[model samples]
Target chain A: MRTLILLTTLLIGACSAGPQPIRYGEDACNYCKMTIVDQQHSAEAVTLKGKVYKFDAIECLVHYVSPLDETTFSHLLVANYDNPGVLIDAKTSSYLISPNLPSPMGAFLNAFDDANRSSAVQREMSGELHNWQSLKRTITTRNQIPN
Target chain B: MSRGLSLILFFFLVSISTSVGNKLHVGQDKPYATIHSALAAATAGDQIIVHSGVYRECPVHINKSITLTGYGMPVLDAEGEKEGFIIEADSVTLEGFEIRNTGFSYIEDRAGIRVKRKHISSFRTTDYITLFFGIYLEHAKSGIVRNNALHGKPLGEANSGNSIHLWYCADIDIEGNLIRGHRDGIYFEFATECRIRQNISEGNLRYGLHFMFSNDDIYTGNTFRDNGAGVAVMFSRRIHMLNNLFHLNWGQAAYGLLLKEIYDAEIRENIFQKNTIGIFTEGSNRINYVDNDFLNNGWAVKVAGGCEKNKFHWK
Candidate 1:
């Protein structure tokens, strides 16, 4: 259930994030707002100007991105929620998965651009070391969690 | 005051009464050939009596107030091709009829009966009641649809439909009915001031009762069993639910009741058994959850943040 909530949050963030950074609510960050990276409300945003903003949690990005008009955006970008500085398109970002993550929000990085980097991250997180398709299949099937 | 004057007055009264045009008998000299034909010629305050048979036809459109009753059980079939009945009229009563085989379309929302009321500013805009719904009311006021059975089989989400669907209606009374095997047993939206009582809703693919953006509706003494989810109340205010039973609604993402963005409501004395969650309340506020029994559910209540001042009594 907790994992589901986190996926729902991520889905919301993904849907709301667009090309231009929308000023969401009282805070900054079009996708998510992050005063810092390690906190609960950290988020990430990608603007139309090819600049990407990273936050501590998904909620910060949602505050701005959720209310933005869907037609006004040009591109979507997100820092691999796991590996900062390695940015990727939100649609193509395969590593951030829904279920079977160590985090409370149930988001985990499954693969990186480099196979060695992915293997290292998998070892650190004690993951099953699945490929991208396997990871997506696992996340999609994880609709329910043991309470 | 004399006998001669009294006799004249009696004749005058009889003449006036004959011109009132109230009673219409079916199977008489001008007996209505079909239910649709009789409905076409009838006026307000008139009665239409039908003989027993199956009428495999399209939806009959009614726009005047009248009472339509069947002598024996009369059947109206959409042939699973078209919608069943549409009532744009007010004060309509349909009794002793079986409506079946409504058209299934994922794109169009169709049902057995559809009622549409006049706007608020229209002349003679009075509230009505839908006592039973093998009856659907849309944008109608004060509809009373009662004492009927609605049955349909749903293949999937795309092919499923609601047995009774009301949109933008108010002051509804749904009572004493058996509704089963549809997508939603009942669906209401943007409606208010309604009461659903003493009904059995089962085997639906979605919810037994689902409504959104509606307020001040009371649901009591209804049985919802073997549905995908028992009930869902969303974006509504000031509603009250009492004495209903939600049972055997168990699946992934299923719950006895799902509440979202609701305010100032009361949920009391309902029984929830064997559901994924007895009640899942998210973004709900100021709700009084009183004396409800939750038996063998995955969770009695799963509450999220943004819920405040919700009181749960002993159960």
Candidate 2:
């Protein structure tokens, strides 16, 4: 009976879907009409209903999710620059904003899995490193500027 | 000799001298094993031949007028570094190379081959993304790009770049190239008097061909298929499009051709099939569409607000 339970648990764990790879030439951004080609600058959000939405840039994803209610999305993910095509939890990842590191939508935000690497890049590229909360604040502040 | 005879003889002699420049070889057996070294040793009107091998280098700058040809299609792999080639001289010809893996950068415009001046041909780029143009021409006058293949892996508009991008260029000829999976297959920004012919651009994320603020350009005998936003010609005058095929470009905002703020253009003898909209026009004036075939499209032609003096003939 215990062996049967363990087998079932393993099957369930394997079946759970996590972050998916953004098909670069094939997948279009949900917000912008542009295709998602930048591996390091892309974002993905999974809704409560399990529908995944991909964004070309982190700014686009932020802009899209900012207007929604907190309960709408189940997960938000960002690509790690050190490892291309790998998604990490957006809330936990560290972001570096620099003029030298230009993002797809001119936001110049890059995500890193390691805080030390983020700080290293910050030293070289001359930018401020921020967590998700601080990065959101900066994005909101930038978006408030009138075009 | 007679004056005319002497002039003809002199011209022939000059052509012979120009064509008979010294040849430099770069191979395992040759004195120079790297293209960079061969290029450094070469002068104007010389020929540098690269043998078959994978060369890991970035930003191969060509500043002298010379012919750089490869035997057995030497691979110039950038390996996700910087750009592959940068040409800055006049009358330079580059041919037969497999240039690949230009790293993506938002601030810099990286490319498989960037021509600031002069000519290139018979090259290929495999799978680039995000502001990495396959072939780029900037401020160049009178060049030719032909018989090349450019493939991109575009996921979004902000990340993808144009396959063949031209800016502030004039009298350029682009022909016989296959471009796929880019933001735009061919993009002309402020480029004038260019001719695009016999190229196949398909499966791109944005328009197969995009022209912005360009004038007096002619595109003929090209195929554009399965693009996202389709083809767009905007803010241009005296443009001629003939004998082109636009097919299977279907999306909510897609059209076979979108003309905005264009003037005195002639679109004739083209085929538009299986597109969301065959032709979408806005703020365009004095344009002529004649003998173009439109079949199996969602809307044949949608003329939006502020369009004037346009004439369309079914047959």
Candidate 3:
């Protein structure tokens, strides 16, 4: 029983070891090269090779991952907009796009782990609520207009 | 004489008589049907002249050191495709064309013209739709990009790109271009020893000119107006900013010129007018600000903490 418990603990620790904490005002975004100033709209991604990529905004993270195969990444983490520096699973998080809530990159998209919190913000902010896939699709579609 | 001897003599004579460079033509009624075909047929030091017409095609990749000149501003429309032109060879020149519709991609830094060690001039880019970059230079050295007009859609920063973007380049010259309505009009990252002069950058979503980690650069006689922020020089050294105009850049978080983590720079003979902040400095050292006009700004100059050995003088 002790051996089984040790194995379980090891597995949990390995799984929980994901992205690192983003250093605000120092670390630059991998996509836009802007300094990561706001923690609320920030994101971090860990590749399979254990490379960490930080983003100043959720839109920057989405744009960086849009052209790649999503399965290659080990973890996609986003910071809670209300609680700074707290990361949640990006795949399971809910997002709201509202002009009232300004982001560092001006996309105005914020992430929330709880659906009820997202809905509450949506009611207050009056913008569209979306899951990860839908939000990615929306950004992709919006950027694909012919010039 | 034998037939083989006669054929050999004819070939030798032709080789001796042919010139070093040839001029190829491409248009609706020209010899070649498409620019790609003309480029394929051209050799080094040759010239390809394209007449005026609208063409819908893939990105024209130039791998040879040739001059591709267009007459009457022929339009190369990508039509939501990837890119308009990709010049990979050194000493190549692309001039006088209307390059349009380089569609945006999340994965790729799409551009109307992507060059490495080339000279680009006399072109126009129209942003009927949103796109990434207008002219993107990567790892290019001693190149020239001048006399271009780039028009971008006035999208937010999340969706838009820059008008001229340079990455890891050095000793390039950018002059006499008119750029508008992108994330940043001119963006440089890890670029060194470049010269930017006499260009007009306006209505950008971000700063008109954004510099990051670039050193030994000089910008003179440029105009940056009505952008989200006028200009930002960060993490750099030995920069010279002279005789430029920064005007009407107003926002809650904006400045006519922002200097951060910079050293050994000269900011002189510039005009800053009607901006949210005329000049904002942070963590900079050993800089000279002389003979610069600050007219009707929210704050003329805001010096943050950690700055040292900076001198400011009025005209």
Candidate 3 has an fnat equal to 0.00
Instruction: Residues A54-135, candidate 2: write the lDDT tens digits.
Output: 9878877877887788577778999898876778889889999897786655577899998999999888889888998788
**Model 3 stretches with alpha carbons more than 4 Å out:** A1-147, B1-18, B117-130, B155-157
Candidate 3 local lDDT, B127-234, one digit each (tens): 222256899988788888888888886443445677899887888889898998887899987789899999999988777998877889999999999887789987
Alpha carbon lDDT of each predicted model: 0.64, 0.81, 0.82
Residue-level lDDT of model 1, residues B182-212, one tens digit each, is 6678887767888899989998766799876
lDDT of 2 by residue, B189-257 (tens): 778999999999998877799887788999999999998756788667889999999999897667799
Native-to-model Cα distance after best TM-score fit, residue A99 in candidate 1, in Å: 38
Q: Which ten residues in a row have the lowest lDDT in candidate 3 chain B?
A: B121-130
Q: What would the C-alpha RMSD of candidate 2 be, to one decimal place?
A: 8.9
**lDDT at B307, model 3:** 96
* Order of candidate numbers by DockQ, starting with the best: 2, 3, 1
